[model samples]
Target: MFDVVVVGAGPAGSMAAKTCAERGLKVLLIEKRQEIGTPVRCAEGISKKGLQRFVEIDRRWISAEVIGAKIYSPDGTEVTMAEEMAGNEVGFVLERKIFDRYLARLAAKAGAEVIVKTTFIGFERVGNALRVKLKRMGEDWEVETKLLIGADGVESRVGRIAGIIKTLKKSEIESCAQYLMSGLDIDENYTYFYLGNDLAPGGYAWIFPKGNGCANVGIGVLPSIAKANAKFYLDRFVEKLEIRGKIVELVSGAVPVYGEVATAVADNIMLAGDAAYHSDPITGGGIANALSAGYHAGIVASEAFEKKDFSANFLRRYDELWKADFGWKLRRNKRLQEFFLKLDDETLNSLARSIAGKNIREMSIEAIIAELIKKNPSIIELLKSFLSP
Candidate 1:
């Protein structure tokens, strides 16, 4: 019987397996895809500081190093913010295909057994272990595991089967559509953001450079308020861009824009990554949080094994670790997202104009919130905590 069984081979799963195996646990990591990281579905941008906190990012996995970003108003007014001003000195656009495989390799080297083209069908409790049903390359099999980690994506089958997470509303999920295209005349060092209700409805559009005149142009929309689906808005935005090359790849996915699940721990099961709704509500970014959660969950799970206890009470440590690290911050960001959803194009344009001449280095979140509150004091009650010192 494996000590831990991790579903999915994304960053979270690989990190969980690696961490557990390094602690002397027998870990099993599985992926449904024939090949890991095929057809990437992310914006692939990570803050330089955030990435450094976990791993020394290998140069092979970096597609571009960005120094700053530009936020555009509905009327084409631009508010340039340096990376330092945003508190992230630089950002790296990753080659996710290479990075995902590199992480999987790390897990394998740490003694975790890795399986590909394997799908987790269901699980049943058998005494103190779990009987995991899996389909491998058209064959069905089962494995016994003391603990299970759900590192699956937003639409997590494992989470549903384990009954750890509830069904999500469309409003709580951000639908995304993106295309990787080359021969673009964009500033390779600056990620561009476009904001307007007509542009992306409740969300926004982005252009993250991938070097070599290539970039990932994408749009996210809140289904609750979107006039059309994400693809329609993305197609409309793409038509207006001055892209010169053919679209090389199309990527589409949904991210849970909520905080962690109500209960990420259930007896011998735990959910991590998107399955636990760890993505940032304001930006739909989850890689950093996913890695952090997986690492902590592994630690907690290992300790549980050492104590010979796998009950929900013993696994509460995992929930505590993630909440202390990121759960609180994610909840605050969700409030910010709610405020953003209420903004109209005129208010967004006014905000851009208000910050046009400010030194980007001095532009902090608090300052921006203060400026916004000046224009709309009615929101003071909602933003008091975020703006407080």
Candidate 2:
């Protein structure tokens, strides 16, 4: 029997296992795939500040280190902003396969039992502990665990089985598609964001450079508002950028941005990462949050063992810690995303025009909001919180 069983071997699960094992818990980490990281779905860009909090920056996994971002309007007006303006976007685009495997290896080094090609079928409550069932290589087996952590991605069967959330709405998820293209002549230092209703209804397209004449080009769209699929928008973006390159890889997936799930923990179970809908609402980014939440969940899970209290009430502390760290920021970003979705193409163009030739590095969040308020008084009330010191 294991003290904690972490499902999925992504950033969240591996971090959780690592932390739990480091805390002297008997941890078991399992992955359904034969390998830890395969068929990458992420844009693989993570801020240096956020990633450094957990794992040390590994040069082998870093494809490129970016300095700033370029935001484009529907009419093709461009605005370049340094990380100082937004507190994000300055980071490294990762070789996700190597990065993911590295984290799993760290977990193994921490004394967590790592298993692959093992699928978590379901679980059953047995008095104070839980009986976890799994299928590996066409065989079924069971293991008992004091606590269970569901770090599975958006289509999380573990959360469903745990009775946390039953259904995810269409509006709550972003449809995404990406490609690794080669031989592209573009700025390899700055990430580019293209915004407009025509470009991606209720969403945006991005070009995250991977250096060596290649980049991960992708788009995310609100499925409810998108006339066509995410791939349609991504293809158009590639054409508009004049990226006459050979497609090297294709990746696609859905990301949950409905804010945190109402219930993240229940009776000996906790959810982290995409399973808990920890993705950023505005950017659709989850790796940083996943790592953060996973670390917190692992700490809390270890405490549950020390106290010998695995009930839902005891596990609720996990949810509280997660909320304290990232829940509030995500909630605020969700409101911002909703406001942006209401913007028309003309408004986007005008917004871009207003910020053109401005030095964002010298401006703070409050100052930027003031400038935007002057250009568009109607949005002042909605964006006033940005002025908060």
Q: Where is the poorest 10-residue window by lDDT in model 1?
A: 358-367
lDDT of 1 by residue, 168-209 (tens): 898999999999998888888888888889989888899999
TM-score of each: 0.94, 0.94
lDDT of 2 by residue, 65-99 (tens): 88777778999888766655433546789999999
RMSD of each: 2.6, 2.9
Q: Can you tell me which runs of candidate 1 are displaced by over 4 Å?
A: 83-89, 362-379, 385-389
What is the Å distance of residue 33 in model 2 from its true position? 0.5
lDDT for model 2, please: 0.87
What local lDDT does model 1 show for residue 266?
88
What would the TM-score be for candidate 2 when compared with the true structure? 0.94
